[model samples]
Target: MKKLPLKIVLLFTVLFASSNLFAQDFQGKAYYVSKTTMDMDEWGGRDMSPERKKQMMERMKSFLEKEYVLTFSQVESIYKEDEKLEAPGAGRGFRMGGSMTGGPKYKNVKTKEVIQDQEFFGKQFLIKDELKTIEWKMGTETKLIGQYTAFKATATVPVDRFDWRSMRRSNSDDEKKEKKKADKDSVKSTNTDITKSDDPLSEIEVPKTIDVVAWYTPQIPVNQGPDNYWGLPGLILEVNADRTTILCTKIVLNPSDKETIEQPKKGEVVTQAEYTEIITKKMQEMREMYGGRNRGRRGH
Candidate 1:
């Protein structure tokens, strides 16, 4: 009995080692479609007529839906949006929400590095940041994602303040507080006509964190995924984060033409924190601008 147990252990160890050796030279591509839901009602769209709401939804559809291609190897991968021409004004939603969507992102699992190309308000920024680590709790629940068997894993990740998926419009209590503050500030101002500015971002609130669920396949045996998702024992096939869902539609392993994986080097280099600060300050300025405009209109 003891000898049989020892043999089984050895056999498992050998298989694991062989899989690692095979992964070292593996290259593949995964095609994914990402979609995020926007609740018009939550954003005070209930007051609009049904036809107007429908028109607004149609206009925002293209911005909330996208396709992406993830080309990956043993330790490195690049995820980029699949480019397609859109109708005029189809992408206006991108301006309202800060950049960091559908940009080319490169990740090196071995070095724990992430290099992303981001364009915000006509300025390009190269975000060189450490790969986000998720403490995934593995689950035994298994299902099939196409031909491969996928297993469930879940984690909770801190939400970025700029993450649109998890953002919600401020409630009545928040609005009241803001109004009170504006009233006080108006009293202090030399010009009694001036009130608080109408900040574009004031009504938006993002949670501190959100839960994520992913499905990964060990058959591919590469630690790569679409977007800023990785660190699993296998390649991630699907991810459900906040209001967004990313699903792999097709996969091609070891194609005839293998492209070299390269990091983006075109934008002004900045750390992730620095980029956040820049956007934050810009949002503040927008609030001031809107506030001044509102005051001017009221004066008239």
Candidate 2:
């Protein structure tokens, strides 16, 4: 029988311990506070009287401030808003403009899959599709967001033209009628012009891109962030997208109790493109129905 030398035994013991420590998964929970400042003038709030504007601002305060929790493991994360009672008159008829926040979003970096639960006009849809990739251009700029020193990165993401709110706002009756007449004229002219191959409706233009700036901390060393933001070299502590800003207020790492990160299964499963089409078609139908009712009232 033979025994290993003292040096070899100690080396093996150290390597075994290091392997176990590295193998243990790291989990973290991040608390984020989101605040949106409303541009009263942009949304027609400026047209109201002083007292009416004040009332509107006060009423919208609760809806603008939101809280979200992001629970993340090494390769998976789930981001969801903290449940709270809806504000009074929240379910009333549609407002002109509102926030762009979606619903519970789940991402798996390992599998490169994203599952987003979205609700539109009382219908639930599970947007199950590949994660949207961002070609982030990292900058040399650095800033401190809370306790973490973060680096800056910027990217341009395409805005979905089929967004219900944007579509509804843009598709007024006058615009619809004008577009229909123009479309008909173009179709008749196309017979004379053999070069015309594109559909007039498909040529309609909308704002295509949104600018996103993110501040991430290498100290955390995890590629996870609020909403659909990811792919940074570190954890994103702050994000500024258009008018919205999401800041991380607190982070808890490797807690004693672990929570499960389960993918949401309840909803009509659809791809992002399909979901966009469904919403677009539904909103068009609603507009037509409402327009018909208004015309009937006018006739009476």
Best by lDDT: 1
Per-candidate clashes, comma-separated: 1, 0
Alpha-carbon TM-score of each model against the true structure: 0.86, 0.75
lDDT (tens digit, per residue) of candidate 2 on 1-300: 899866445434534553433234888899998877766654556578889877787676656667999999769999999868886876344443333336889999879999998876667778999987888997757777777667789999887775322221235677667667855664555243221122222333346777899988766767889988999867889988766789999988887898888898878899999988886787566555654554454446
Tell me the tens digit of each residue's lDDT in model 1 across 1-300: 345555345434534764755545778999999999988899888899999888888777777888999999999999998978998887564454544443799999999999999888878889999998989998767788999778789999999898777888876886878878876776456573435435667667899988999998777778799998998878899999999999999999988898899999898999999999998898777777787876666556
Model 1 spans with C-alpha error above 4 angstroms: 1-23, 87-95, 98-102, 172-174, 177-197
lDDT of model number 1: 0.83
Model 2 steric clash total: 0
State in Å the error of residue 177, model 2. Answer: 14
TM-score computed on alpha carbons, candidate 2: 0.75
Clash list (residue pairs), candidate 2:
none
**Cα deviation in Å at residue 217, candidate 2?**
0.7
